[model samples]
Target: MPAQDHRAPPMPVVRLVVSDASHAYLDAVQRQIEQALLK
Candidate 1:
């Protein structure tokens, strides 16, 4: 469970994939992910 929890956030970023995103939401999440990476 700990391992799965740790791996979960990246499943999106690693793929850079959003299953049902509109353009604006995708852009928003991308920026947030980049900020998290920077921190």
Candidate 2:
């Protein structure tokens, strides 16, 4: 698996960083949409 590989390790780290950023962005957008709906 890519995660188990110790050599050439940048891929997993980059994937994690990108995933985290996207998740945070999506959460922020969801909150805004919810607020708009409630108003």
Tens digit per residue, CA lDDT, model 1, 1-39: 999999898988755555545666888999999999999
Which candidate comes out best when scored by TM-score? 2
Best of the candidates, lDDT = 2
Error of 2 at 15 (Å): 0.3
Q: Which ten residues in a row have the lowest lDDT in candidate 2?
A: 1-10
- Count backbone overlaps in model 2: 0
Which residue runs of candidate 1 sit more than 4 Å off their true CA positions? 1-21
For residues 1-39, what per-residue lDDT tens digits would candidate 2 score against the true structure?
Answer: 775676568888899999999999999999999999999
Judged by whole-model lDDT over C-alpha atoms, candidate 2 comes out at 0.92
